[model samples]
Target chain A: MHLAVDISLRQGGFTLNASIDCWSSALGVFGPSGSGKSTLIRVIAGLAKPDSGYLELDGDVLFDSENRIWVPPHLRGIGVVFQDARLFPHWSTEKNLRAGMTLETTGMFSFEHIVKLLELQPLLKRSVNDLSGGEKQRVALGRALLAHPRLLLMDEPVSGLDAKLKEQILPFLARVHRELHLPCILVSHDLPDILRLTDRLVLVRDGMVCGQNTLEGLVTQRGAFDMMRRSGLMSFVSLEVDGEPVRAGVRPDEIMLANRPVEGLSARYRKPGVIVRLIDHGPTILCLIDTDEERLMADITPDAVRELGLKEGSPVWCFFKAGAVHSFD
Target chain B: MKSISPAEWTALLLSAKVAFGAVAAVTLPGVLLGWLLARKNFYGKVLVESLVYAPLVMPPVVTGYLLLVLCGRNGPVGGWLGRTFGWQLIFTWQGAALASAVMALPLMVRSVRLAVELVDRRLEEAASVLGYSPWRIFLNITLPLARSGIFAGLLLAFARSLGEFGATITFAGNIQGVTQTLPLAIYSALQMPGGEAAAARLSVLSLLLSLMALGFSEWLARRAKTGRSTHAPCR
Candidate 1:
């Protein structure tokens, strides 16, 4: 799915100016709170019209100020899973899910399919108000999918959930995008959550798209490195499937950079690779390493970097403990 | 205790018919106007609002006089009715219903507007995003959510219609077995010396009915106001 947004909107006293041209089945929009991330999601969902620009989603003109064209939200066939899980409180879970389905719904994403996919069978007859936070979010996600939308817009879908509930809902989000092949724009302030789904990231700061790149690519930019450090730049890694494929993560702090390979070491991953870039902050330098399989980021002290002579194109081994590779299933 | 005389029973039945007819006539229009007033902002909003509420603040006599001029025989609406349907509204039971509805309209509008405004707007927007048309959302969400408020408003309007007098007296007249509602019957009874016992009985029933209507309406409104389970169990 491709989206082109060159728009400016003034809401109250804040003006949001964003220009993003991205194509990804799972596009992640990451930003801090009050950075207009949700506003961007709303614009894409056609919930809010841009003041003076154009928006084309998958070749459909959603909004074009110059042409006097504006598509209504329901006509856009774009579904939104709001942050607060705005399910109709008076309706049952089954009713809420069916609310998104029209007569045109085909056999692909049928009622039984989504119900089984989201595991909503047991909760179908229950009142929406009676469901737990995680369950409500799952229902909200299923409802949006049942709409059969070309693009799904989720604004802080799991931000309101607690840590345990968030852990419960993330897998459903991943399955929706991966198995169903649903194109979604997931907007959230949490970086790790977005990384868990897709690395194709759009960084929004102060109502503007500060940078747009994959999580690995963004790590190489000096400006992006410092900003990402504030949010803790822990890059996601797709581990090779021995029997079952599992997505793993490596925190920048867990990675140790070495100039020469030592004979004995307990760290599981010790691959000799080339250093692509170096981002120097005040006390430490963030090294971007390109292994044959993936790009890894390791944070080491300036003293270590100076001693090892780690620079662009320098050969080094990125080491991390076996336990440091956190698996997401 | 003596049983109700035929005249008193006729008067009682006519009052019920007029009040029931009045409530029925105003309900649909009242709800529409209430929703419009609560949701829309357009040209001459204040003027439209004031006109809807004018009957509430103005003396009932003035409203009666206006209705009399507009709907009386030889008047535009009365003449059209006479010509089109060969029916007359002046000095009839339907005329009393018209007067009662006019007097009770403001109460209905005010109650329904407040109720519709209290419905969560986000829910409606969510329905819209879920592919519901505005009318369907109103039918499925807004109306059900505002049900208690509307019931309270209807009861209040019914109560107001039950006791309507000045306008009914002016426009429909106090003819026996026709427009002589409970209050009109009581007013007629008080003028005669031997009508004391009958008037006393009818007056007590009227007061009791009014109090009961008001009490039930208040109870329903308070239940909704306290955020209770009336909003629960809506399919």
Candidate 2:
């Protein structure tokens, strides 16, 4: 599906100027907490109208300032899962899940099928008031799907959840898209949220679309890398294990940088490699090493890297204790 | 004094009927206006708010005078009704009920509006996205969520209607077994010689009715304050 949106919206003190022309089933809008990411989702769902521009989804004009055409939210056929899971208090879990169902909406997203897909049988009769945060979001997703909307808009669906609850909900979200093939826009601040679902990223910062490209493509650019890194206070990271029966994990900060291989040290697992990239994060810096076997990321102080004269393409040795690398099945 | 004179019973029954009719008459308008005041941001909203409060703030006698001029026998509205439908509101129980309803409207609207405002607009937005229209959203979501406040308002209005005097006397006129509700009955009894005992007994009856309605209204209001606000699913 092709969605072309060129709009300018001002809400109170914040003004958002965003434009996107993309053809992707699942899209991710990545930004910080106050970066107007959710506002973009709201505008797409027809919840908020932009000041001047047009939004054409699949060649259908949802909004057009020049022609004076604007579709109301109910007629937009775009379902949204709110961050708070705004379930009806008077409704039971079953009622909430079936809120969007009607005579015409039966086949592609059926009530019985959704109940089974979300494992909502045990929760159907229960009051929405009694459901957990994760359960509420699941019911919300089911409710949105049962409406048979043409597009789905999710605003921080799992960002509010704790790690364990987030883990529990993310797989369900992934399955919903994989099985149903519903075109969706997932808006979130965290990288994992975008990576788990779609590679197409629209990086929003301070109410502007700073970059729109694939994850690898955007990160290679200097400005996109700095904005994304500072937004979440997390280093751009990826993991790959090569040539071993064991799966090992180690904190990037623990992998200290050294000029040469130390013959006798308390730490184990010394590997010499060339620094491919160095991302500065204020006090500490991240060094991407391309080892003989694989590429590994290590975190070290700027002083350490500066003292070792380590720049891009400079050969370096990385050290970490054997106890630091935890093995997982 | 020892027994409620057949006349006193007439007065009690008439008052209950008038109060019930008053409550029924105001329920629809009360809810509609209340929801409007709470939800809609429009031009001249303050004018509407003042109009709703007029009956409560202005002397009931002046309001009755206005109603009498509008709906009196030769008055335009009353003449139209009399000519078209052969209906008469002047010096009738229906006029008494109408007067009572007007007097009770502010209380009902106040409660309904407060409760409606407490309902989360986010939920209604969610409903709209789910394809429910504005009317369906109000009926299914807003009204039900605000049920407790509406009930409390109904009781308060009922209590207010039971004690209506100035408007009913001015427009409906106090007549024995017809427009003479509790307060009017007590007043009528006191105007006669050696009627102190009858007046005292009927006054006590009026007091009991008011206390009961007030107690119920207070109970509902307390429950409304303490129960079912935002159920944090996250908890």
Candidate 3:
């Protein structure tokens, strides 16, 4: 499937002009909050009309202001999973899923298949209000899949969820993208969530499509790296782990500190580095460690800093486990 | 307590029929108007809203006079109906139902409009993305979600119609066994000598009927509020 969008919309003070052509099965739209990521998805889903431009999906003209052609959302065959999981409160989970399935679309994904895919057998009889946040999102995904949409738009499906719930729901989202082969444009501010879903990224900033490339390619670009850094994303590195070069990322919080090299530990990597700077990060202190090849930030509690006598130019060992590092690309 | 006479029984039955007819007459138009007011933004929205609520604030006698001017035999709508369908509403039971409907309309519309307003617009947008047509979305989402309000509106209208007095007396006239509903019968009973016992009996019956209608309305609203199955099953 292919989608070509070149649209511009002006809403009060925000003007969004985005142009993207994507053919991947799943594309990630990564940006900070208030970056118009959701607006871009809304326009693609036919929920909003752009001021000027054309949108084509699989050679079908979904919208073309010059041609005066605009297809209503219902006719656009695009299903959207909103951030809030807007389920029909009055309908049972089964009914909400069935509400989107037409007779002709049933052949695409059978009811039994969706029920099995999303593990919705137990939730079928429950009302929407009875389901938990993760359950509701699964039901919403099933409902969207049942519609036989040519493309799916997901707007921060897991942002509202806590860390544990995010981990629980991310696998299902990836499974859906893989099993259904549903082309999706997932908008999210979280980098790990985007990386876990799709490697191809569309970076959006200030209502513009800043860059579109694979994660590795975009990370090398100075503009994209700066944007990611500003958004609090940790830097990634190509590390030789077990004789294979893997692209790995270590979060600031996951990096432990040691005054000297201590053997017989569970952590896989331990590198001695000099403390370049120490910055206060609210309750925790962020120590900028200058390793031989790269600078890594380690979050240490204020108590640890005082007890360890940590200061700039102090020698320290940064410890992180291989399991804690997320490998992408 | 004096036993209800045949004339009083006729008045009671006629009152029920007129109230039922009024509720039936106002339901469709009332819901349509309520939805329009809740969802649409037209040029004369404020004017239309004010006109709809005029009957509630204006004296019943003024509403009756306005109905008379618009629907009397010599009036435009009444003349058109008489010529086209041979239907005359003046000085008849149908006219009393119409008068009651007009007086109860504001309550019905208000309940329905509030209910419609409570529905989340995002749900409607989600429905559109699910490939539901506009009419289907309204039918499956908006209408069902607002059902409690619609039902409350119906009961309110019915109760108001049952207790309607001034508009019915002025527009349809108090004719025995025809337009003389419960309230009109009470009025007539209190006017004559030695009619105090009859008036008391009719008042008791009216009170019982109104109580039953209101009790049912409260029960329905409560059920609608708590009927959803919220407890999850054993995992």
Model 1 has an lDDT value of 0.85
Please give the C-alpha DockQ score of model 3: 0.36
Per-residue error (Å), model 1, residue A27: 1.5
**Interface DockQ of each model:** 0.46, 0.32, 0.36
Clash pairs detected, candidate 2: none
Summarize candidate 3's per-residue lDDT along A119-175 as a digit string, tens digits.
Answer: 999999888888899899999989999999999899999998887777667878888
Choose the strongest candidate by TM-score: 1
Candidate 3 docks at the CAPRI level of: acceptable
Model 1 C-alpha lDDT per residue in residues A196-239, reported as the tens digit of each score: 78889899989999999887778767677677777856865665
Native contacts, share recovered per candidate: 0.43, 0.54, 0.70
lDDT (Cα, tens digit) per residue for candidate 2, span A139-219: 999999999988888999998899778876777777889999999889888775666688788989899999998755675
Cα DockQ of the candidate 2 complex:
0.32
Model 2 segments beyond 4 Å from truth?
A: A231-329, B211-235
What do the candidate models score in CA lDDT, each in turn? 0.85, 0.85, 0.88
Clashes of each: 0, 0, 0
Residue A240, candidate 1: Cα error in Å is: 11
Considering TM-score, where higher is better, how would the candidates rank from best to worst? Answer: 1, 3, 2
Model 1: residues with Cα > 4 Å off, grouped in runs: A238-247, A260-284, A290-293, A301-303, A309-315, A321-327, B207-235
